[model samples]
Target: MSGQTMYEKIWRSHEIVDLGDGFSLLHVDRHMLHDGSGPVLARLKERGRSVSQPDLCFATLDHVVSTAPGRPVTSDNRRRTIASLRDGVAEAGIRFFDIGRTGQGIVHVIGPELGISLPGTVVVCADSHTCTHGGMGAMGFGIGSTEAEHVLATQTIVQAKLRTMRVTFVGNAGDGVTAKDLILAAVGQLGSAGGNGYAVEYAGRAIQTLEVEARLTLCNLSIELGAKVGMVAPDEKTFDYLAGRQFSPKNELWNRALASWRDLPSDHDAIFDAEIEVDISHLKPKITWGTSPAHVMDIDGIVPDPSSTGHRNAVQYMDVVPGRPLVGLKVDWVFIGSCTNSRISDLRIAANIVGGRKVADHVSAWIVPGSENVKRQAESEGLDRIFKESGFEWREPGCSLCLAANGEAVPPGARAVSTSNRNFVGRQGPGARTHLASPAVAAASAIRGVISDFRTMKD
Candidate 1:
């Protein structure tokens, strides 16, 4: 066969059976479970199923865990969910990262943080953003509850082959432009469904230069682009980031892993089903104005006409007129966390911008780290003090308002500039209007009480 892509390499290596009709049974290397996992495990038990290879499985309480400073379970339903997962994992002999544990946090966040997500491995979780693991050059994707159960029982999943697409973000990303901004620009250019039915490989000078955490942020939104998986080629930066990480290979095994990862990049002669290039040289920090991520524009641009953009309902719900500029749009809430931008780098960038500035009185701002480790690291670096001193709540780590499932949400009809991945209506709460942006933008907006650009803010 001709040269193959990295996706093909990982997939072919893990594929145990070529179940015909375009499907293959692939062995799972790492499986992550979260609060939502409770119900699935319950159903698995109901059918007399049990976990296979418990050592390969990891569980944590996110999604339903409250990220309050005390980190309370918060409600009866959340209490039950926590108990179910807590009890189920113990019975199945799976490792559980319970609340306040070192690994506790969003499954996607802790996977890369703990090194459980390694280069060239197949990682799966019930969360859509599990694709975030691809930053380490792994072939990771989200699975449904049923598929997750299947992996729990058999340690294998049947998947249809996906078409491959390479989205090469060209040019250098300037100051204030982040991985979040770059990926948002792609969603705007390709539309949310752009990568449908395909696995996307992010490449180019820009992607190659990204730090490991930034790559995770970039790959985190692949699902938003309708991609089944998203990955970047592993390189020295990736290797350096993973070296000595908690779960990474050790000593001799480490050298061997490095050798394997170095070979995981797409071959120079490899071909893809689709190739698209985006020039981010002139791009500004992007923000979503409508209900969908595709309805985006730069901080300086006026909103597109609703009829022309086919976002009349979005415009109506967002309460924006066609010709209005995005900057200076009033916002009531500012959230800087999620699987996407909740890494240490993301927090440091935002804290740098918010160091001496106070969040506007009318804007309620919150900064949540992605995992317990991230939370502790930020505290060690005084990031929490910087945020709290500036009138932002430096809260505990969890999904928090990202999913709004733990009873935390932006008030209805309120506007928020958030760093989370999605801005779909009711995503943050019922009738809440959301504008998605990078952590820098979220911080700037929190200070200005409006959709302001961080680039314009002087420290």
Candidate 2:
């Protein structure tokens, strides 16, 4: 038998048939929808069609909804979109997690945290970070709005089979190095499009050591490297994280699921189309110097000289001088919450960093949970109190700050250290500057009023 990466193994197992021209028809097991995409399905209903597999599709409101406490959704456009979602879900008999409902959060975050994303499942959503579910050893990706309509009509999607790339991270990370930093370093080394036309399998001791939430953060950015999907092999960590979640199987069924998941890893000598290795021991807390995710350096390192590279446009967009250190750069805001780092663990880490500390008077900070459950979990542990006492606004759960929707945005020319997935210029707001980092780093920067390191601060 030929060797295969974990991605290839899972893909082959789910392949319905080859459709020629490099494309194949694959079966989809889980479908997720957000309020923004829900209206499309409602439009399809006007044409006299219903969801093909209601049981497999789920909907939740995240985008275009204010996460501020006691803020009723007041925008007419937003209300119409949400109303369409409610009507569509009811008409199709699909599950819907309405605003204020239990288990509601960002589409990517709520899926995994609820255990609806399982090993070997084929998941898809209208949002790009659908790849986040791949951390559970599943095959998942995002689709366009029209394609989402097709999936709602039939529980399958047409797609071209992708090449497989294997990324192995060796050695343990040093103090203050996080999965975010490791991925940033990988992006720097490989360039932004290195994984183009491939599904990436992340393996090695360092990756296995990460908690499930951290692994999700790594997989969440796979698309940034131009990969269709990114995944890690299922193991104890994956199972442990799902053991007690609401949608997970219980008792005997749990044992069966675990046994099935145990066999999901790729066999020894599985061949990959391409391979790259990274040394995690050399990783450090990272910060983005340019407008793209690839333009990154260690927190202690200086911004790259634009004259040294052909990508002058990026340097110009970021408005940074070459050889200037990112540390001590004045920032106007700090944002902590996104599908990438809104898990309860992420909140705890940020809270610990700013527990008794106050944000610098000049910097505004926002803390949005990925989901309502995560919000409640943080509040139960008093993590919310820590953030509030430190002058950080702890808001409701949603994709707040990660995207500029719902009126939550950083003003133009404002520099922000965010825990969101991308650092693309204007991604958070028009002409806004975004520097991506981990939750701890965002918290530390909030306290110091600049790009600061969390390791220097003790709880």
Candidate 3:
């Protein structure tokens, strides 16, 4: 057999033959939908086409639902989406995980955490960060609303083949460094458009050592680097993380699944279209310096002088002066929770930083869980109490500040440190500046009212 990259292997396996125009019809093994996108699927049925593969589609109510524990669902948009999801699931026979349901969370988080995302599967979602599933070695990407409708009707979509990019990170990650930091560093080095027209495969010792959540964090930012998808080869860590999840196989089936996952790694001599290398030992906790994920620097580094760099438009829009210190920069808000870092472990780490701490007098902080399940788990461990007592608002689970979809948004000119992906200008809101970081860093920034290091705090 010929050697191939993991992307090549998976893409070839799912190929349904070419359809011309640089696109090929591809079979979708798993299709996830959410409140924001569920309405479109419902409309498709209104036109008389049933979901071709109901078993292949899953629906969840998240994006606009009230994340407040024990609170009744509110918001007209949310209500409509939830109702449509209910109707769509019933009419289409798709699996649904509604709010308060056992499997409910951010659709992206629910997939891999529940083991519905498996090696070699082709997963598609209506959300961009769907690449997060690539952490389990799956081939996944986001789809637009119209495309979502197509997948709902046929369980297939057309995709252009992509070049493969290999990013190898050697050496141990220094203390306080995380997969988030590594990806941030890589994006910083490569620029936001670096991985355009390619899928990225993360390799080397540092990547191998990352836990499944950390690996997901790495792949989650792949889009920021312009990759269509990003993935890490599944290994023992992948199997261990999936072992007892709700959708994971059990008994002899579990063993069979493990055996298959173990073989999903690329061969020793696999070739990639391009390659990049990073050393994690030199990486630091990163903070976005401009409006993009590529505009980043170490937590302790000075804000960049846009004059020194080439992205003049971004610097002018960000209004960041050249060579100013990023440390002690005043921020209006701090947000934690998003599909990116809203898991239980992410909450635990943020809580450790916020416990016995108080938010700066002038700063407002919002802690939104990624899902109802994450909220329940965090509350059970008293993580919510720590956040509440720290002057942070512990709200219901939803996209919240991540997308400003539920009337939760930072005002214009407000600067914030966020745990969510993307920091593009007006991404949070018009003129609302966002700096992306890990949850620990976001929590610490809230306490200090500036970008601060979590390593200085005691657990």
Task: Mark the regions of model 3 whose C-alpha exceeds 4 Å error after superposition.
Answer: 20-22, 68-75, 307-310, 456-459
The better candidate by lDDT, 1 or 3, is 1
Best by TM-score: 1
Error of 3 at 457 (Å): 4.9
lDDT of 1 by residue, 1-459 (tens): 678999999999999999999899999999999989988888999999899889999999888788888876668998998898998898899999988889998888999888899999999999899899999999999999999999999999999999999999988877778899999999999989999999999999989888999999999999999996999999999888888988899999999999988899999999999999999989998888899988899977899987654598899989988898989989999999999999999999999999988999999999989999999999999999999999999888889888799989989999999999989989999999999999989999999898998888775
How far does residue 164 in candidate 2 sit from its true spot (Å)?
Answer: 0.6
Candidate 2 wrong stretches, greater than 4 Å: 307-311
lDDT of model 3 at position 396: 72
Best by lDDT: 1
Query: How high is each candidate's TM-score?
Result: 0.98, 0.97, 0.94
Residue pairs clashing in model 3 are 67-396, 67-397, 68-396, 291-423, 305-322
For model 1 the TM-score comes to 0.98
For candidate 1, list the clashing residue pairs, or say none. none
**What is every candidate's alpha-carbon RMSD to the true fold?**
1.1, 1.6, 2.1
